[model samples]
Target: MVSKPSSAASARTVSVLALVAAVLVGAFLAPVVYDAAAPTPDRVAVISVDGTITSYTADQLEEDLHEARENESIKAVVLQVDSPGGSAAASEQMYLAVNRTAQEMPVVSSVEGTGASGAYYTMLPSESIYVTPSSVIGSVGVRGSAPIGGSSNEIRTGPDKASMTLDHREAQIETLKHAFVGSVMEHRGDELSLSREEVAYAKVYTGARATQNGYADDIGTLQTAIDRAASEAGLENYEVVEKEPSTRSGIILLSSQNGNSTVVVEESPIGYDGVRAPQFLMVYGQVQYEDEVIGNVSA
Candidate 1:
């Protein structure tokens, strides 16, 4: 019409219309109209192992582990530990419970302040262990008052019946150490980089040194431990739930199905003076000498 627009101009006009059409079509069908799918969240159960590991502490741990086991939401467990060790039997019970939990799902032992001796022993059952740089570890040994000599006032039936002789006591301790060492070796297996003698000496290793010596898998933070647990459990988005003891009752009360019940009360800051018999305790601390008076003032 104005010389009927040139063929080149006509082609350009059609190209512009086609471009606009494509843009308009794309806008109508854009994915931005829909929100992204929500990620499935998993649950991680954290149980504390603070202070000394007593029989009561072991009971709580068992209950916590059992609860976690029963909960379908819990994908893994993290033992947040800070203990200088405690009763050997209690530690063993906790270890057995942890081992059972591991068989079901991933379990991680994360050390905070100090996870030594019996506390460290409890770690053997975990799939992996993590500790902060300054955390204490090891002291793979036991210490308790060895019934020094038989009572002169008390009459006994046999030579060893009155009390465990010094020799037998020493031998018993060695037996206990052997068993402890065996458990450590069995659990750590080829991952153990330290020599048998090093382990036998019951030396504590720092986090970095522990990893180097294979006493620990890595030096990491609590979050790192949780993340490791999550990875082991194959979880992306996850929830962390801490299971604090529901009751602070310092009493052990039990009742049978037939209604026979019993309750044992304890003194706060409980004394470990062998009230439950001389304990084969896997504890670490300055040992009290016979000559020194306990709970003495510095002044």
Candidate 2:
């Protein structure tokens, strides 16, 4: 016959089993408890594009976008835009910069006040464009002062030194317009309800109209855009780090009722350096005028 085990041995065994179970439960819950106690969120970078998009502004914004791309901590980017657009070449530069950044990570654009012409062009590569009810967008076109006749006594190295013919200027304008419209179609074609020709009309639409016409995404605030960008980056917990550009006084170029345009060279945001030259502009609103005005195109 076998002897029965002692009651003390059974009690000790039960205690050991209970201790093992407690340790298992603690191991499972430690990470959850630590996460809840000190939450560390991902980061989203906010870059602002205010005022006219001149070479100076484009340079600043491009640098910011480059930084966001290189920073491993920045999971996403939100472009805070509020501008009427400016210099065509500068705008193209911005477009390229934004496109490059978007390729690496998620990029979203938020139009605050007016995002027309070149400003619109810069945001083409964004995954989504958020705007407020009063925000404006569109104006997909190009403009420039027509080439003017050189002085009769002025010596010229070539036949087109001072200015080109009207036909040549028109051709240049058409080319730029085609490029702008084509970019719009390429980026938002699937969502747009308007035709290429209609886009060429260069009409500025309100936020609601822009959404309906596919020029913009759903109506949302700047914060909403930031949240959307974080979501797109697959970040449930995130923090926004705004990258503010250097501040400088700006010269406001206003167009009078009589169709006259005036530009102040001093501290001008357009970066013209006080010289008005005939150059293609992807911009909306009033224009700066020069003596040899071939044409002042606008919407």
Please give each candidate's TM-score: 0.72, 0.75
State each model's CA lDDT, in order: 0.77, 0.83
- The residue-by-residue lDDT of candidate 2 on 1-299, one tens digit each, is 99988999999999999999999999999999998997456799999998777777899999999888888889999999998888888899999999999999999999979999999999999999999888889999987765557557778898767546678878988988898899999999999999989999999999988999999999999998899898999998778999977764543232322332233344444555554445677778875432322213121
The clash count for each model shown is: 1, 2
lDDT of 1 by residue, 1-299 (tens): 36688999999999999999999988876755443454445799888987667788899999999999999889999999998877778888988899899999999989978889989988898888999889888888876555545677778787756656667767877887887888899899688987776798988878777887888898887788888889999999899999875445433221112221122233335653212345667766642222322132110
lDDT of 2: 0.83
User: Using TM-score as the measure, which candidate wins?
Assistant: 2
Q: What is the lDDT of residue 216 in candidate 2?
A: 97
Top lDDT: which candidate number? 2
- Give candidate 1's total backbone clashes: 1
